[model samples]
Target chain A: MARDTRERLLDAGLALFAGNGLAGTTVSDLEARAGLRAGSGSFYRHFTSKEALFEAVVRQELDRFRTSIGDTTIGESTVADVKIALALEFHEALTTLGQLGQLEAIIHRDAHAMGDLFDEVEGLYNAALDASAARLNQLMESGQLPRRDPQALAVTIRSTLIGYHLNTQSFRRSARRVPPADLIAILIDLISSK
Target chain B: MARDTRERLLDAGLALFAGNGLAGTTVSDLEARAGLRAGSGSFYRHFTSKEALFEAVVRQELDRFRTSIGDTTIGESTVADVKIALALEFHEALTTLGQLGQLEAIIHRDAHAMGDLFDEVEGLYNAALDASAARLNQLMESGQLPRRDPQALAVTIRSTLIGYHLNTQSFRRSARRVPPADLIAILIDLISSK
Candidate 1:
């Protein structure tokens, strides 16, 4: 029961923190969202403070992301197959990162107060870049991709995906302007073109 | 003097709104930041409410941006010249958008409450995309660039730049991972590759 309550608290923390940010969200807000009586001391029973709860929320989300990425296995034989596989990866990445939008907003708003938590998130971002660079390098070695700086290509691909994600997520109207498939098709054409 | 105060208020609003957000900043905070006596009605004398001041600040920034873009004339004869020109444009864009980082954070945080202001900003964003598409089309027509969906290409280019900017600005450590020139060079190579 304690573990369940702790999970509930973490879930509530993620939602409320994303909505109201660190300074705006109160202890009572978390408790009420968690199905506990508002203004009750149940919050204290689970965590030391709101900041601690925020930390827990971030760490839990990162672990879930790590697990999800670890489970992904990209096995494709041809360049065309790799392109399709990469498109799926891009879609999955968009979904995963979209879920973390609120957390991202909180981090952007409260980076100064977040301290080490911010570093941990940055580490995750860099790891993603490194992973992307490795994948591109493998593709290049197998003659599936054109010869180019894998690191630069990784950054390019990651940036394009992130940019599209931010535009569609942040602006309601931009969703219709450029579809994911169109962007992905162009990206594949650009990098694979001899 | 009143006009000067209004300008100062807008300036202060941009910095304060970026740092503390709209709700977190009080009128007294704006007044103090603008060199007016705190608790005085100086803020009221300039604008009706905080929201109105925010609207003015956004509009003024947009106007400044329009003026700057209008002043730029990219006249490169050769493909290599066009590449250098585009790189310069990217650098200029990074600096401009970086200046708006705080404004963007506030917009992301307070989009629900921003109403029409949000639409106006979205309009400006789409306008940028349109401008980029037009430029790409021109390059393709002139045979300086290969033919593709110009809109998709514009989206790709813009997304990459935005992704890099967000990564570098949001995280202190990401600035060192990939230099702007390296990313730009790879992007140029990708699109121009036959």
Candidate 2:
């Protein structure tokens, strides 16, 4: 019950913060949004202040993001199986970032002011890219994949996934856009070193 | 002198709107930011209200964006030159978008509620994309580019550009990251059919 209340408070805080800048949202606003008593009474029981709540939300979202990328396992045994595994992994990771609309809102509000929180988020992003590159390098070394340029291919995959997610979600344009699988197919073709 | 003042008002609004939500920012705030006397007097001489000023800013920014992508001429000559030219054009368009930190803020606030203004902005983005695709199709038709999948490549370029611009600029993690020229070289290699 205690954990549920805490989660409820964090959810309210994220929605309020994302839509209204931190300065625009108030304690009482969060209280009401959380369906708790108005004013900071019940809110204070859970959080020290709105800023504290904001920090909690950041931590919670980061955990959620980490959970979303549960695994980055590249291959099991076969070469062809390795290729399929990578595409699936890439698609899943991209989906999480693409769907992280609310967290994205928080990041855009000059998140650098939040110090370590922003650092963690950005670090996670870079780690994702590095992991992808490492996986490609491993496959190349094993003679499974041949992009003739594994390093370059790794960056392109990461960039296209990021680009596709942000554009489709942000613009809300292109209702009939290219499916992710089709894009993965193209990436695989480009990965070949014919 | 009048046009200069108008431009000043638009500039002020763009910066303010991008950083602060439309509701958070006031006319007086814009006036002060523009170095004009506060309280909307000089502002009135330019825009009727803050909303009107926002519209003018959108128009000005769109014009600037279009200008950034001044020309997309392929070539009457060789495939390599044409490839280089297209890559250069794509890079410029992406640099503009990636560097649009301020404009991005306003977009996230769902400024579409402001109506035609947001439509115009979104439309400009779609048009830029359509133009790129058309340019690619033209090249493929003329046999200058022998890709088995020109359409896929066109979309990939646009998506990767959008993704790369958004990621690097947002994270600011990799100050010395993949240069656009390097990405372009990778792209040219991908365009090869053999």
The best candidate in terms of lDDT? 1
* Tens-digit lDDT string for candidate 1 (B1-194): 45688788998998887776677678999999888999998899989999899778777776776676665555332446777777777777777778767666677666776777777777777777788888889989989788999998888888888878777777864443778888888888888876
Q: What would the DockQ be for model 2?
A: 0.47
DockQ of each: 0.57, 0.47
lDDT of 2 by residue, A2-66 (tens): 55877788888889877676766788888887788786488888888788989888888888777
Query: How does each model score on TM-score?
Result: 0.86, 0.84
Q: Score each candidate by Cα lDDT.
A: 0.78, 0.70
Question: Lowest summed-lDDT stretch of 10 residues in model 2 chain A?
Answer: A70-79
Off by over 4 Å in 2: A1-3, A19-29, A37-42, A74-79, A147-152, A173-176, B1-3, B23-29, B37-48, B66-71, B74-80, B98-101, B148-151, B173-176
Identify the CAPRI category of the predicted complex in candidate 2.
acceptable
